[model samples]
Target chain A: MKAVTAFAPATVANVSCGFDILGFAIGDMGDRVKVSLSDQPGLRVVSITGDGGRLPLEAEKNTCTVAIQAFLDRLNANQGLDISLMKGLPLGSGMGSSAASAAAALMAVNELMGTPFTKTELVPFAMEAERVACGAAHADNVAPSILGGFVLIRDYAPLDIVKLPVPEGLYTTLIHPHIELRTADSRSVLRRQISLQDAVVQSGNIAGLISALYTSDLKLLGRSLKDVIAEPYRALLIPGFYELREAIQKAGALGSGISGSGPTLFVLSESREIAAAVAKVSEEVYAKIGLGVDVSVAEVNPIGAYVIESV
Target chain B: MKAVTAFAPATVANVSCGFDILGFAIGDMGDRVKVSLSDQPGLRVVSITGDGGRLPLEAEKNTCTVAIQAFLDRLNANQGLDISLMKGLPLGSGMGSSAASAAAALMAVNELMGTPFTKTELVPFAMEAERVACGAAHADNVAPSILGGFVLIRDYAPLDIVKLPVPEGLYTTLIHPHIELRTADSRSVLRRQISLQDAVVQSGNIAGLISALYTSDLKLLGRSLKDVIAEPYRALLIPGFYELREAIQKAGALGSGISGSGPTLFVLSESREIAAAVAKVSEEVYAKIGLGVDVSVAEVNPIGAYVIESV
Candidate 1:
């Protein structure tokens, strides 16, 4: 029997002004999936762990199992796999929970099948799996979770992914608010139309953010983190978001904004000290609001989805 | 007695995906301004040339002369200068004719006054002068013309300008059709509102363009040059623009788009050979329609406004 196990890192998508175009992976927080050859002749969900029964047990409804099914369907092979998902990250925490599971399953399956497809070639399977969770095949989360570091979805249709270098010393602080905010509900909060003036400013900010990352200009990055289009509409949904953002800024964060469709918020800084400081500020602000939050400081994940066990 | 003459190169703004935020300097085509001490108590215009008597001879109305006055006002100096304007570029050609004049005049005046300001510091003075011609202070043309190379205006409020490196062997082909395209008219053609979906796509393109520039990935640069907002609305004003763009692409151009406000189109290529070929295609496309167009082949201008003569 052929068997493989893979790990994919958690990612933060819609990074400030980039909306659906930019994302970055972080830390060791992710999902572990084990794929083994199955005699059932179809994809099967053998088991799932760590998700607190939030995810579906059925293979057809699960993101990781669906990704494996899609991968086999694309290959036009009758070969099937049994998938076991370990969700280290929480569902709808704005930390690419679904994307990690999807990417890890695909990676494990690809390795079990002798790695016929390239890593980039597996992006589609992961994106399709996102459809099962978010009702859209969005690649912002999956691309970085699979490929690592900073990833840019240059264009969605046909899906052009550009891997950007994350400058050394850049650290991130993720504050998971322990509140439930569905990705679909957060997406629906945004207005369909925006003023031209707002769009122009947003465009400049996006360019500025990319330049900041490449040139290592943290001050510019902080100033360029204004998200007029989405933030103004979604700020009310995330309780104490503005207060947490203010506290984070006071603590010298490079920038702070909503992490994907958030109740979870993320802050970027140049050092672990700053990240820790920002996390403290975030925890204090959330504590005042009678809310519990989980904080982690980590560098950008350099390696994305990778094999842990192969036979 | 002190005097100085300066040359400010013409600039191309709105580099496809950037709209009002990005610009680059190009070519020998520029404005020549000579500023000499008058020993009088205030500013005066000596003479104007090459403009067919279109530009203002009075110090108050001329863009270059206005910049000098603003510079002196900031300095709180009573010194006076006689200015001679030599317009090497045509006005309203979408080639930054006014900005070149303003930058050159400021450079000459600053040198004659023993240089109280840095080149980057002179950007606002030149931008302020743009108000004389375009009815608004826009720095996209003036910043690049004054600073040289590629420039990104991250924000207009605090005036954060980023100087981007120009990759080696990148050449430009500019086609000026001698048609009238006022800056305000081109701006007026665009809708005040844009869909969020379109805004997201435009934001992605801007990020992609900046990434491509830094990475020196010419193919990625070409692919990222889509203008979803400005070009679609402004293309109607430029006759045969679509066909000419197609021809330039066929001739191995990296990307082609309407420069600045319109009536001028610019194409980027990897080599001078490709630029010349693209220019030839541009000329032929305009010639077939009984329009006489001026074509210029140039590399990214490394030096912006500078002193030609100082004593």
Candidate 2:
């Protein structure tokens, strides 16, 4: 039997000023998927670990199998397969947990199928899985998880994804607090109509961030990490959010903002040492607030998803 | 007497997706200003030409003298100066006529005073001139006129302006229709509030535009040059706006949009020949509507304002 195991990195979406359009992959944490051919003529979820028995076991319900099924349907391949998922990221943690699983499964299944689709071509399948998981087919998380580095979802109709350059020494400190904030609830809090002034401010920040990435201007990147559209309202859902951000800023981190929706925060730093310091500050702030948190400091993952073990 | 004459290029602002924040300088068409020291204790306007005597001769009301006065006040220099304004660009044409005059005057006066401030530092004084001219201290016209190339006004509170790279072989075709459109009336037609969905689309286009400029991808740039925020409502004010855009697009121009507000339109092209072709197409479209138009094709001006003669 041909077997393959793949790993996909977790991602931080929104990235401050780039709500619903920008995201970047992070190193050292993600989801893993192992796939093997089976005699049965349909896909099945053999096992799912690290999700605390919360994720669905059914193939159609699971993001991993759903993504694999999408790829198979696109290729018109009906080879029976068993998929096992290992979720390293916390569910509902704003760390792209579902996207990581779907990306990993698609990578494993694609490798098992002799690599019919390129990584860029795999993004739509992952987005389809996103639609199954979160009811919104956003590529901010899935594209970065599959293609690595920074990804900009320019448009969703034709699915335009642009990979941006990552500067050297750029590191991130992510803190996921042990709290549940439904994506629906977080989204419901945003104003459907925003002032044109605020919209102009948001666009200015997006343009600045893109320019900063191309020029490798860390200071400008920090300055551009502002979210006037979503953050002002979403901050009310996360406890100690402002305190943690202020502490991280004082700790020499370049800038910080809500990772995706709520409860997870990301701090950008120019060096590993500063990232570590920001991580420490994040921990102290959360500890003082009596909130348990999982903190990780990692450089940007330049290579998103890859094969781990193939047989 | 020490005299300096400077020239500043006209600019095209609101480049499709980058409303209120983006602009680029155009070559071969602009305004000229001459400043000379006098024994008198205050500034004086010696002459004004090329405006059909429509511009004010009073130093306080003119954009050139007002900007020069601002610069002189900043330097605390009490030296008298005689100013000469020659407007090469058509007024009320959406071609940044006021900005060019202010930028040229600032460059000339700055040189006349021994060049105390760099070009970047002179943007605010030029913005002040914009306020005197249009009642808004906008940098989209002034920044590109002073600094050259594509300039993004990232923020207004602290005046953060970023200069973006111009791709090789990129040219612009500008068509100025002989129609009167007040800036205030054009601005008033826009909605004060917009939906969140439209804001996201606008930001996506902006990020994509910046990324395309960095990568030098003309196709992506053309795709990203969409304006959902300002174009729909403003298009009603311009005669045959949609027809002109469609014709230019069919003529192989990358994209086209209203230059600043209306009446003047800009078409971005990959080469000068295509730009010229698009200009011909634009003229034909306007001619069918019985509207006379002034058409020109020019590359992006990389050097903004410069002293033409100093003695």
Candidate 3:
């Protein structure tokens, strides 16, 4: 049997002002998938680890298998395949857990099949898994997890994704509090209609953030990392959210906000030392609130999903 | 006695996706102001031309005199000055006529004085004139008119204005169909509230437009030039608005939309040839409707307001 193992890193979506369009991959934590070619003419999920038997075991219901199925359907491949998933990110933590699994599985399957598709072409296949996991098919998380670095989904109809330039010495600290904040519950807090004034403010910040990325103006990027649309309502779902953000800012973070929906918050800093300081502050804040937390500090992942071993 | 004459070019605001935040200066048509130091102790408007006696001659009522008064107040200089206004642009044409006069006057006065403020610093003073002409003190037009090229007002509270890089070989065609469309009327058509979904789409386009500018991807820029928030309601006010836009697109123009509010339309093109073609098509479209039009094509203005003559 020919087998391939691939790993895809965790990603931070929304990035404050870029509520639904901007996201970036981070190092140190992610999901790994192993795919093997089989003589049987079907797909199967042989095993799933690190998810504590919480993830669906059935091949058709699993995000990893669903994504691989989409990719195989697109390629018209009928050969049998067995998928093994290792979830490195926590579920419902708003850290793109489902997207990581889908991306890793697609990467492994694509590599096992002689790398038929480019990394960019694999984004939509992964988005199929996103649609299965979340009601809306958003590309912010999956695109970054697949392509690495910063990704901007400019439009959805034609699915335009643009990879933005990353600045040097930029680091992120992701802190996940041990709390149950369902994505659906978090999304329900947002108002469908927003004031046009607030919309303009949000648009201005997103524009500034993009300009800051191109010019490598970290200060401007920090200033532009504000969310008026989602954060105002979503912050209420997370415990001590405002206090944690204030502490992170005081701890020398460039800016901090809810990473995706809730429970997980990403703090951006100019240097690793500041990022470490932010991590310490975040842990202290969560501990004060009697909530345990998982924290990771890493530079933005420049290389996204990659084949770890192919034999 | 010292005298200076300055010219400030007209600007196109609300560049489709970037409503109330993005604007760019254009060449050829603008307003000119001559500020001459006199022995008189108070500011006075010596002459006003080209406005057909519609503009106020009183120092406080006119945009040019009001902007100069603000500049003098900031500089703490009470030197008597005589102001001459020559309006190169039509009034309420949706082409930033008021902003041009304010910028030109400020430039002339700044040159008459020892030039204490930088071009970026002069934006707020010019906004004072905008407040007088329009109820809101908007910087989209005044900022670009004062500092050449594209300007993005990231924030209004602290007055953050970012000057974006202009792509080479980029040209614009501005067509003004003779009509009476007030800015207040244009603004009233807009809803105070907008759907969050539309806001996300608008933000994505603005971010893409900024990225397109950095990469000089004219095609992406054209694709990003879509207005969902204001264009839908405002388009009904302009005659043959959608048809004109479609014809311009077929004429090989990159993208086109309402210049500021209505009556005037601005078309962006990659080259000078395409811009000329767009201009011709725009004229023919207006001529078919029996509406006379004024059309001009020019490259983006690199140096905004400058002293045309000084003595």
For residue B22, give model 2's deviation from the true position in Å: 0.3
Q: All candidates' TM-scores?
A: 0.97, 0.98, 0.97
- RMSD per candidate (Å) reads 1.6, 1.2, 1.5
Q: Which ten-residue region of model 2 chain B has the weakest summed lDDT?
A: B72-81
Among the numbered candidates, top DockQ falls to: 2
Superposed model 1: Cα runs more than 4 Å off:
none
lDDT of 1 at A212: 86
Residue-level lDDT tens digits of model 3 in B1-311: 29999999999999899998999999878999999999989989999999988999988888998888888899888999999999998898888999999999999989889888899988988899899998879999999999989999999989999999999989999998888998888999999999999999999999999999999999999989998999999999998898899899999998987888877889999999999999898889998999989999999887898889999
DockQ of each candidate relative to the true complex: 0.89, 0.95, 0.90
lDDT, candidate 1, A244-295, per-residue tens: 8888888989887788889778789989999999989888988999988999
- Tell how far residue B13 is off in model 1, in angstroms: 1.2
- In the range B41-70, model 1's lDDT, one tens digit per residue, is 788888899999988887778998788877
Question: In order, what lDDT does every prediction score?
Answer: 0.89, 0.93, 0.91
Best-to-worst order by DockQ is: 2, 3, 1
TM-score of chain A of each: 0.97, 0.98, 0.98
Docking class of 2: high
Residues A236-309 of candidate 3 have per-residue lDDT tens digits of: 98898989989988988888878888779998899999999999988899889999999889998888889899
* Whole-model lDDT, model 3: 0.91
